[model samples]
Target: MPNAELPQAKRQKMANKTIGTHNGTFHCDEALATFVLKQTDEYSDADVVRSRDPAVLDTCDIVVDVGAVYDAEKKRFDHHQRGFTDVHYGLEIIAKRLGTALDDPKVQYVWLKLYRDFIEAIDAIDNGISQYDSDVPARYRSRTDLSSRVATLNPRWNEPTGAQILDARFQDASALTGKEFFQALDYYRDSWLPAADLVKDLITSSKQSADPSGRILVFEQFAPWKEHLFEIEADENVPSVEPNQAIYVLYPDEAGGNWRVQAVPVSPSSFESRKSLPEAWRGIRDDELSKLTGIDGCIFVHASGFIGGNKTKEGALSMAKKALEL
Candidate 1:
């Protein structure tokens, strides 16, 4: 079946948060108003009152913009949202990542979004995807709307292997270079941040080579839970809240010596970040860590990078460490 049309409210809701209201100081309610106000630079206070119209968002700088920046002085739009997917998935990943660790109770809500571009892309390749599903066979196939013989694509998903399984679900990704297919993969990947190097960094840092200069110097950047929305899922099996972002300092005993991971603790104060993206990260963690940063824990994995929103503290830190060996 073709993609269903989205209701105006859904579209408006998306625009208000990402695109910003055309004009606004007061939004719909406490949550929405606060959300919009925070997006605007001067109107940081949610209680502050002003206009409430998408048009009034004119004062909003380029940050809240989904498209080109409206240069009032130039009277021309410069710099567009540019693929738009980046911001949509970027924020979504952060939100969902925290969602995985909702048990903390400190985080009220967690959400994720993909812009219209992704919807359009998926539609473009419906035929090819359907054909691939019909032609190929695997351990399992997902059912579509409880239909007959609808092989599930998301059956008992495996961690990083999900991507590889998805690629094989249809045709050879190498031969099928369709924009739709690629967009789907991008969406899939963005949902979870890669956890490759974080393992390497932690493992190597754990080593003590006896060289002071070669030792790891541990530094951590933490943020408060206020600005962030952590989500802890309720699993009859296991329930937990995950950290949205983190940074670890692997300081060895001696300088320049291969510093072992002497200690790994979550920073107490999780501060909001000032970056080019929507999600806020711990200052020290985001700055120092690379795309490979992630942590696995006893009950969850507390990954700093993306892992389809956020991996649990257990899933993030510990599970990710295990994945490094692969």
Candidate 2:
């Protein structure tokens, strides 16, 4: 009674559903798309078939990154076809049909959010869409993103083009893309989203508790605040929160065991601070900083005047308050 002798019904039940993609030179978009589809119950045990043959692809229940068809109802997801858009129409359909809670911070929500950051890049690359405007300086161009990395995994021009060789390379590409996708998904769900809530709460509280200027935010604990700060301020839903009021933030520095007063940037990613510390304190440290600032436990201020440190929370708060007056 070997396993081969099992009944046809039992064998069919145990067999994996088929997922089809192009055979040669796989890119990040398809590799990640396949992995994403596999995560769902409908394709949890899917067997990936890498081929360009119409006959082979037709047998697969779902096809992605190939076949030149963009029909969601027909289970086709190719962006190479003319008139194909970057929207994840198939995913949106699945989300709606399943009644996924868009409000909840779950996998579906994370998936949708991540599409903007990760999948959109792949779609843009596959569709030859430039991320930045055409007028952007050549020096400012970004090189070697996830798509480029995945493209590199394909067999080099000199490498053998045999079926086995191509298959092996495709497997390698799939694994690399899958790993990155899972890591990014977990990071957004576990770290980025939670930190955002905390940052928003701090921003609201700061507005209420700060002096009339409403410029300084005091954090109960240090966290990644830059991006969240800008997002919370610009959020249209929070009508009471003024987008331009915050100029500085105070938090504890874990490594140095000191408190820090940091200038908020004009924009989330900008290097220019909204309001710098006093020019006299720039690059000054310890005793010199204390004497100039007339504040005890003063550590040092950065040469750029973006940040300064103090031995106590009170000292850091004082530094920000004094800088505000200056």
Candidate 3:
């Protein structure tokens, strides 16, 4: 039969593509890889096939985390091959599948953001890389992370290990990962990115008029500022700002109708600040704090000197400026 003469149903069946991965135990990487691929127009309806047979993989339209091949052109994306250190293979595959250039500024931002927030941990676990250099014990243990949650979907050692059984579990794993990935995508795009722009504007304005020292920023409205503060300071496009230059951030306390002066941390992840409020003021409150700092409307300063509150914005700014001089 001539190829064009084939029936519509048979032609449609042939067009339904297959996504291949190794059969047996599944990990977060391949499950996530499969989920990402299925999101694109090209593979939105693709079937998943789990197998170790090269012949079966060759028959599929694309393969991931199997076949010992990492060629993008060939549609194979296994990281187990010798000397393969690219932990972001999933990002590349997604960019290519979406037909969006990786260098596009928006795409680049989301790429790095998602990688930092979500994808990096998965890659690290799959590659057997430790998060810390030393063997120091963690402060606490957490088993509720996405990777850990995915592992719980696998069949128990004592339970059924049939091919159909495993494939069903793989689907569940893919659904679990895909749901979280999309939620993260929505948050970064809808909320976090807008907050970054607002922070940048406020930082620039503060350097111009609000604080001549460029060491204090007063926010009329609060956005999540810590991560954005660090990111803006490190950005090469913004001029005259060194890392950790901004020492204090002042903002209104919506609930108490007071205002707050907060010390920026040494780094976004650290509990320690670049500079703390004066030692004498720490743990002081009310009239004593007002008398000690000579700033009116004083409420309290934290014991650790990371934060203090005042009844007004002017009082908070005065507190921050006084602390800067000390």
The candidate that wins on TM-score is: 3
- Candidate 2 lDDT tens digits, 1-326: 66589997777765768999988677888887887777677887888899999999999989998998988788888878875754653354334333555444344555666787777778888888876777756775555788888888777888768778877777777788878876776677568778888988887777677554668898878889887777667878777657878888998898878999999988878889889999999999999899999999999999999999999989998999999999
Q: Tell me how many clashing residue pairs each candidate has.
A: 77, 0, 0
Model 1 / residue 112 / CA error / Å: 16
Residue 195 accuracy (lDDT) in model 1: 24
What value does the lDDT take at residue 219 in candidate 1? 19
Per-residue CA lDDT of model 1 for 42-103, tens digit only, reads 33332221223435544443223222454434222222323323322224332333444434
Off by over 4 Å in 3: 3-7, 87-103, 136-140
Instruction: Tell me the lDDT of model 3 at 308.
Output: 98
By TM-score, highest first, what's the ranking?
A: 3, 2, 1
Candidate 2, residue 7: Cα displacement in angstroms equals 1.7
User: What lDDT tens digits, residue by residue, belong to model 3 across residues 1-326?
Assistant: 97579998888777899999999988888899899888866788888999999999999999988898887778777877774555434455435533567665656777778888898888788888888898899898998988888888899989978888888999999999998888887677678878988888888788786796679998888889999999888889887777878999988888988999999999888989999999999999999999999989999999999999999999998999989999
Q: How many clashing residue pairs, candidate 3?
A: 0
